[model samples]
Target chain A: MRRIESCFQRLADQKRKALIPFVTAGDPVKEVTVPLMHAMVDAGADIIELGVPFSDPMADGPVIQLACERALAHNTSTRDILDMVKTFRETNADTPVVLMGYLNPVEVMGYEAFAKAAAQAGVDGVLLVDLPPEEALDVKPLMDAQGLDMIFLVAPTTSDARIKLIGQAGSGYLYYVSLKGVTGSATLNVDEVASRVETIRNLAQLPIGVGFGIKDAESAQAVSRVADGVVVGSALVNQIAENKDTPNAINDAVGGILSAMRNAMDQ
Target chain B: MSERPDFSAFPDARGHFGQFGGSFVSETLMGALDELTAMYARLKDDPQFRADFDYDLAHYVGRPSPLYLAERWSKQLGGAKIWLKREDLNHTGAHKVNNTIGQALLAKHMGKPRVIAETGAGQHGVATATVAARLGLTCQVYMGAEDVERQKLNVYRMKLLGAEVIPVTSGSRTLKDAMNEAMRDWVTNVDDTFYIIGTVAGPHPYPQLVRDFQCIIGREAREQSLKQAGQLPDALVACVGGGSNAIGLFHPFLNDEGVAMYGVEAAGDGIETGRHAAPLSAGRPGVLHGNRTYLMEDDNGQIIETHSVSAGLDYPGVGPEHSWLKDIGRVNYVAADDQEALSAFRELTQVEGIMPALESAHALAYARKLAPTMSPDQNIVVNLSGRGDKDILTVAAIDGIEF
Candidate 1:
């Protein structure tokens, strides 16, 4: 079985929700990413979404945007990011790593080549913010051929028709944006999210991972009740931003939040 | 590139102009795009909406702008007779108001009480502000921090017109970044606000609607050309930033088999220097700012910073329809360096007493080169897209004058 499918299945058997931690690769520096990924998994992270730094990140709020700038400062390339995943796969084999960012970088590398290289590097899935299922006609087949899952986002405003389309095209879990704004913007109403999750469950059979505006342990716990997986991005990236000058503090600061959320979800 | 069989039927149902244009935005904005598309489809052919739009254009915008013949400049060039499309004479001193008015009417029809826009040269901001003030809608405009500093007069104009100008400080801090901020705003306030995209770009329905609204420029020019010159001009020239003015003029004359079209891009220093904004001349195909088009990006698919003397022409991508037009050999994409455009700006001021905006001067620069190669009996129509009054400070700074 593919790594993403197996990872989710194991979490289902344990009767616990999945905890997903996201961080931009090569932020602060390149050497710290692989270590951080391993440390997050140790802190109860089931899946890791590693952001490939792009010059333009429109959907991200201030936190992830700054993280991308810091990563790109060292001139991190897509090849370097793939190498990071390959190194992480050396010691860790259970946790799935998903590459997330805009589509231009992958377009620069060509769809077929990126799919092959990512699969070889032990990457499990890809979620490009700008590429909807309508524009995924060419790349989806290439990714499916490599046994790599194509994850897609489902927003609160997504129509029933598009949900059906995305459900058919996607392979991994669906990312449901908890709010109407960009990542790291204001609060998410749990009741509203619950209603949307219920609607999405009726239409698509895949596991739903809710993201955007998930700041702390309490919010993550609240989301854990309604969602199969809780995806936290900007909150962890903010920790990296606050401790960027002292790189040693980044891992502990980021891991602390994931650990706290993990404990709360387990309770 | 091979020629497409038909130019009229484009941007089919899915908004793809032969795979160049599509809705490549985040899922959050998809519903908003769908709503806007549905509304526009209903109103585009309605007689009442057409009559309302025409009434505003005639009295409010001072339309049917003259097609003045630049007799002395053409005679001095020893080439084709040059006719200028006086879009500079429109309200707000540019062709930008034509689109803002059209979109402002759409906002009125939809009962949206707030409007937002993004600006590069500040022309679009001023135009949007002017319409928003007239319509009594709360308006906000996003501009790059760098542009706010350079275009202070227009910034003050926006404020005077009761529009809030928000300075965006992210990314390369220019037009593309401003657009990113606008999209963020729309995604958050999709229920109450309408995003009036300034050019023929962005996601679907915007390119189509903005093109349909601004097509008045070409439609008017075609009729005026037939009356004044007794035939369509031999060729057409317009500067391409996001390519609103160029496409507006070209789309109406698209089916005219004998009329050639030229879309001039800004070559900041030169195309060879890798520092210019001429994507069609130098860059490759990639997606940016919600659509697939030619882009100025690095090897890793990251967008690179583009340079241009004219702030309005300093974008890294052209309109998607321009990409399709170029691919199908309908429009000749050309470039003009800063020095060449500057000289054209100065010469038109002295010879014709009409100082063209620096962005429009790029088109004039290319026209100057192309006209001399053709006979005097031939004609070239240059879109003087905006007046240079706002650029006086920029010209003075270059000439070492304080005021």
Candidate 2:
């Protein structure tokens, strides 16, 4: 937790908004996933959100949903993701890796068992998209006891009162959905999201990361101008989907997009 | 545990209907579901809850929705007597509100400040939004982008009811995708937000919980039918999307050896064309959305995209209880093609002066076909699950008739 806090602090001190890149573990091929994580970290991702492939991913856009489908087709599971994280931690102990996915697989695996597996695998945080703050009462304590950060998402439609509740319940940073739609949707009101992030900032001292519709460098840069971090998911997944069979092309495409977004934000 | 039938109310301690219902979600959601199951067990029987729910059903929803005998249509079919369970008269113009009202009240009782749900035709979303608005709770509804565009009127209605409509643009951009997004939201917000599932599908408690809430449909139909005809109906017919309405109407008559149950599924083009949503007819048993049930999946076990003229029936999976029922041979499942359902939609509107949602028309079409074969004195109860106001645009577009 302290290491994660410092990562955010360092990004703040450097005047650089954190770049949190999301990738579904075991996409394209299970063998490539750990190498992809290393590649992402080497490409300057501040935090890595390792997406556990779920059969149904409701909050995802077409790109990530397809990525999950591909990963699941390859027989990826919670154990496969934990194996990826364990491998990821061998070289990069300081980079925070967050497990983001739906709750069914985790529930099937058992909460206490999952938390223990995650901790043992060197996972730092988790974000189950359908587990609301109130329902997180039991799981949050388990995660807390296991020293895993319980990440939460706050949508534009979230009420102020509920926002506060989520802020208090969430650990690490808050993920603010930029639009009132699923991931990969194109219409994003960045100014509106920035203001919402401001409100969240006032409510809690934790770092805020904006996601959902940051599809390109311009959008990512715009989001970075206001929020503490920018999360680019659908765009990256789309790149992966377009070049899944060609590893170099997949890496090149994602690297190009990330590099451009990073450069734009740095300016 | 005795062989004697238990007429007890729900959140059935072990979560079963004679070896059917039980919690099947991921371990992460088990504790929350267990909490909900326990809370509902306590509240369902509590006098205060019973009184409050009864009052809402009486005044707010204007329930005990009339059970009308369709004399003209029954005569035209030239067979068994036909009766319609008027769920379309319920508030929000569909049977979905029955479960929404019960679940929303439960949410309030559990001290949940927010509610989330997934919608296909937007009936459930509208119903949920209406109840949430009345209760002054924050509501978020996830709908597929295609549904948002196709069911534009309902999208606006949900927004008007003060619920946030989040369009899911993933995985076929239909009902299943919307379900995925709602599940994501529930997992993320599982602490305080109660997920109001639109259908009697999903994992253990939801299938049982929704059926128990919607069983009011069967309970009322049975009582009213017996009072009017002095006997149980010979047949019960209802369309199966997620199978909530069908299960609701069928549960009360499950043990009646003489009563035949028919669940009509949507055949988009035809079952032979491989473009349909007839889960029981075309699908194999598989686990999806928290339950092990029959699903239209490929050889790789990936859920396939289902097509139907009625947006409500375009789902790859049927409710788990439906799976069990099909396995036990207690209920027969059949399919009605898009063309057949469309003709029935028009036939019912012109013959009965009632515009039925395309989903409900599938069942109506099946009833029309089956009525001619039944004896004159036999009775058939058709569940008119929803009104067709939401389908005018789609129907008009299909007919190339602009207002």
Give interface RMSD (Å), model 1: 0.8
Model 2 spans with C-alpha error above 4 angstroms: A1-55, A58-66, A69-246, A249-267, B1-27
Fnat, model by model in order, equals: 0.80, 0.13
Candidate 2 lDDT, B188-301, residue by residue in tens: 567788999989887667888788889989989999999998899999999999999999999988878788999999999999999999989988765577665788876434
What's the TM-score of each model vs. the native?
Answer: 0.99, 0.69
Task: For residues A1-267, write the lDDT of model 2, one tens digit per residue.
Answer: 355678998888898999899989888888877887877777768898888877676566667878898898778878888988999889988899999987656766667998999999999999877666754676899999898998888876666676788889988998887775567876688879878888988887679998888888898899999998889888888888888888667766777788888888999
For model 1, what is the alpha-carbon lDDT of residue B277? 96
Error of 2 at B356 (Å): 1.5
lDDT of 2 at B113: 98
Best by DockQ: 1
Which runs of model 1 end up more than 4 angstroms from their true locations?
B1-4
Residue B183's C-alpha lDDT in candidate 1?
A: 91
lDDT of each: 0.93, 0.84
